[model samples]
Target: MLDNLPLLLNGFSLAVSPYNIMLMMVGVFLGILVGVLPGLGAPNGVTLLMPLTFGMNPVSAIILLTSMYWGALYGGSTTSILFNIPGEPSSVATTFDGHPMAKAGRATEALTTAFVASGFGALFGVVVVTILSSWATRFALRFSPVEYFSVFMLAFGSFVAFGGGSPIKALVSLGLGFSWASIGMDTVSGSMRLTYGFNELSRGINLLVVVIGLYGIAELCQTMQASPGTVQPVATRLSPREVLRAVLAMPRYWIALLRSACIGVWMGITPGGPTAATFMSYGVGRRFSKAGARFGTGEPQGLVSSETADQAAGSAAMLPMLALGLPSSATAAVLLGGLMIWGLTPGPALFAERPDFVWGLIASMYVSNAVCVIMALTTVPLFAAVLRAPFNITGPLIVIVCLVGAWTVGSNRTDIAMVLAFGAVGYFMSRLDYPVAPLVLAMVLGDRTEDAFRQSMILAKGSIWIFWSNPLAGTIITVALLCFALPGFTALWRLARRQFLPPPVASGR
Candidate 1:
């Protein structure tokens, strides 16, 4: 550990450089600007900026992009608190108490509390990243193709079993993602399988294009088609002294903050993203809050718990990206692009060869997070001004961003078309009790799943029993498969049993 000091310091130096600092500030500013808007979200904003990085230095490029991601995290809370609209899915949790608090005439307090919560949560995330990165590196090194395959299978299984919906619909989404994943030039046979006749099809579907289009562009289209909701401004003020007092109001909340952060970190360490963390934390917060009844009506605990978890998840999401070359979110997906542009490959080689890149990025997270807090405090008035923008004007701007974000991925016009097409699909999915996260997760992990299974097969030399022959591989596969299949099996048994059973008597009767 002592021998690693020099490299750690080098990373700090690079991350703290004037140019990188400026990039962080710029990213945070842009992130907030978009986040505070009505329809724009973090992923769309991050995706739109990726194309411009093609000509920049990788480190600077990364600093800027990551800063934006952090900024959006901060930014989303503003809308949730002020207008009851979550610019990002993660911020939906924030709306329960944040918007209600505003409606109850504690606008300034809720906003400030949210800001502090985001920073505090982010702080916990940085500490986790700083302390656990090395351990993560060690663990990631043990992941062979079999391990990765099992991991993806386990993750997808968890989603399917837990995702509340028709099993057929969920499976359809998963299979579609796998099919779309197969469209690229075959990684093994070098044969084109699904490209139809287009030359771009041979180069295959770009993950960024698919994700950004599906998540962002589609979301915006749905928003545009729907009736705009009520979004009135709240006028309130809280002094520094008052804000500090507000933060200290619930000493117990600090415990909640820590708890939420842990939940977020755990989710990110797995394949889950901030949305997963947000929902999980929200559930825990609901169960634990002393004033639980006031949560969706107006309570600071609801806001604090949700925001804290989201930041923690976002922060921890970086671990797998840095340690194992796995990206758990769309922002991480963009960061993956930045890593490639920087001429760095993520894997065991990274830990051995580029400790500075790893440490510098990790250390920079501390600086950038602190910077976010201070900047937000000083710039509260500025963010508040975002409320001044009329919805009529902001709506078009968000749409423009969505379109551009959709087009930026691969410069493919088909991707642009898919954005609107998928937007309707996404909106309807939302209406039908289907989940988008599982679909996106499937799309992201599909290729990796194929690669792992293929490699494991090749290693086994066409022997079907090879997976079972290795004890470790066998156990992981068995667990993953069981995790995936058990819920449906249980559901089927319940359905069959229900056929012979009579309905229960009414409670009153």
Candidate 2:
């Protein structure tokens, strides 16, 4: 870690240049707007602005883009808290309790806590990226096809097993996502399986379109049906005393903060990304907290858990992309494309050959985290006022944004239709109390899982034992199986204990 300090200093010098600093500020502002608006997220924001950076130096362009990513992560929680609408997929878990807190007249406290936690998480993740990235890159080199498959399997199993819903429903949702992900043309066989003769379907469904419909359109539908107003007006200001109390309470959950950051780093280095990390951290917080029974009922721990993990994972994802040339998330994939366009190849050689660009990107993340957190905290009351507007006004605006975003992403009329269909599906799923997150996560992981499994099978001549042929792969597969069975085993153990133990007799007073 210390050996990299000179490179980090050099990177900081580049990032702090006047032109780069101005670009970073602009990117942060735009990212917040994109994140606050429904259907626009980090990937879309970066993609929209990428062409503008083609004429700039590689370091400057990266500084701008990564700053935007940090701002988006911070901005997403605002909509989730005020409107029960997750502007980004990573913020979905925030809505579970953030909206509740806002309705209960604790909007200021909730927003403050989210920003503080996000800052802490981002700082930790950036430090990891700076110091331990080389080690992480080396570790990732040990992964082969079977090992990669096991890692993805572990993510899927952990999410479904601990998703806090009906196991059957979670499995069904995941299966449906897998089905949707499989609709695209197969790269290995060069044949389509589920396109059903539709040329558009041959390209498969876009996860971005699905996210917009499921969260944006479906939320508007539910808000309209459940109440006339989208959200109730509440006190959106925090006093000095109230702010101090909230800040003081944070230290009590230090264990949760540390644990969530670790989980986020692991997920980011692997393929789980911030969405999965947020849910996993929330689940862990719910199960481990003393107030476990009150998890989703305006719990502050829920906000901290989700926000910390989301920010940490979002920042940490850049590590693998920078060090190993592997994109851990969709946004990272877009950034990877940008890197190639700029004639920069990401790998171990990146550190030796282009330390300036790599360190500049890392330094920018640290700077952006501080800037965005302060910006988000100051603007909380302003955004909270949007909740006072009538749903009748906000609802149609949301639908229009969704339509425009979907249409413009690929310029395809079929994507607009797909959004509407998904919106209806999301509504019904919510009405049935089914978890929607697993479906989205499964869609993200499904294609990668299939590719890894197929590659492993081909290498092993169709022998399943290849997953256990090496110690590392075997251990990963073992852990994945355990994660899958843990919930069932715990249930069966409880049942057995109940059946064998005698009930306590009530004594008459």
Candidate 3:
């Protein structure tokens, strides 16, 4: 233990170095900024700068990337609380009460709750990753291709179950994303797909361009469809009395933190990201709160629960990368890619070879968490000021940034076109009531899903039975199948309930 402490301490040294600490601060700052912006997220933020990080040292590169990751998550709650728009999917839960808190003139209190909870959750996640990483890796390694494929299936199934929209639309969006994911050359046949016959076709769609197009440009265009307006952020300063009370006032909130942390830890290791964790934590918070009656309407607990889970999930996602050598989320994937770019091989060997790097990252989580809170507390008023900007100005700027971000990804004009195409598609699909989450999830998982299926077939010597042959694989498949059937059952139940209950007459009507 003492020996390990020295290694961890060494990691702390690097993490706290002026450059690294500054990077982490920047990451938090960016996280907050991006989180405040609608339609942008950690994935897009990371991919937006692939070219820059490609040449940097792994350690410094990681510090910058990780900090950005943290910052993006931090910024998300600002949108949720101020405008009722979730800056990221993970912030969806925040909408439950964060917006209302602003509406009720308790915006400062809500922001404070969100910041503190995020720090607490991040701290918890760091501890989990530090102590249980080896165990987590061992468990992850037990999954074979068949099992892995089933897990993907489960993720999709669960997505549809909880999407709260039309299943066909969700499937369509997901299929589109998966099709896009297939754009690169096929591994076995080396055949190009969906490339439209350009030389750039061989490289496939750049995800950064896709994200910029789908979220940023399309979102801007959609915003143009409406008359623009200015939104002044609700301004309220918390007094020392309120601060002391808010800090120690809630016992129930800690329970919410625990549950949110569980959601974060579970999803971080799986395909789930901060978005899923946010949604799950939100639902759970609503279900568990006795004050549920006040939910979605200025309840401090709502912001705490959603924001806490968001940061926790983001932080814990580092475990699979470090311990199992698997990159579970987009940011983690890029972090893995960055490690490769720096000539470092990750896996069990990485810990043995660069204990300081691994331990230092762990220590930095604590530092970053503290930094995020301190910064947020001092600057909540400033963030709220962004809401004061005229939508006409901000919308066009968002469009330009999206376009530039897309074009810059590969320094290719083709990427800009892709962004426009995706943005148009996103606009149409969104209007048609398609749930976009499945599509984004599919794009992220598509290649991996295909690889898993193919590997199982190869290992089984072309036997389709390989997908369901092993007991673990078979069970996972069976369970996933059951999970997939849930939406239909849910629909039927809702219908039954509606038929049985008569509508109450409105007082005015």
**Alpha-carbon RMSD, each predicted model:** 3.1, 5.5, 4.0
Residue-level lDDT of model 1, residues 361-434, one tens digit each, is 77778778877766765665677776665656776676677778767656778877767766667667766766
List candidate 1 stretches off by more than 4 Å: 1-7, 164-167, 236-238, 250-252, 289-294, 378-381, 406-433, 468-472, 496-501, 505-509
Which of the predicted structures, 2 or 3, would earn the higher lDDT when compared with the native? 2
lDDT of each: 0.75, 0.78, 0.73
Residue 419 in model 3: shift from native, Å? 1.3
Model 2 vs. true fold: TM: 0.76
What is the per-residue lDDT of model 2 for residues 19-119, given as tens digits with 9 covering 90 to 100? Answer: 88788888887777667764456766665667667788999999888888777777788888877878787899998888899898888778878888888
What TM-score, over all chains together, does every model reach? 0.89, 0.76, 0.86
Worst 10-residue lDDT window for candidate 3 reads 226-235
Worst 10 residues of 2 by lDDT: 227-236
The local distance difference test score of model 2 is 0.78
Model 3 per-residue lDDT at 229: 60
Q: Model 2 clash pairs?
A: none
Worst 10 residues of 1 by lDDT: 227-236
Q: Is candidate 1 or candidate 3 better by lDDT?
A: 1
Clash count per candidate: 0, 0, 10
Error of 2 at 342 (Å): 10
Candidate 3 per-residue C-alpha lDDT over 1-509 given as tens digits, one digit per residue, 9 for 90 to 100:
34456666788888888888887887777767766765566666765655576676667677777877877777777777777777776778887888888788777677778877888889888888877755654566677777778877876776666566787676787798799889979866788877788787789775556666666666566656643563445655656666556667555587877888888878776656677788778778788877666777778877777788888888888886776445555566656655655677666667767776677778888788888887766666676676566766766676776767776667788787888888888888776788666776677668778988888888998987776887877876877677678777878898987788865664575
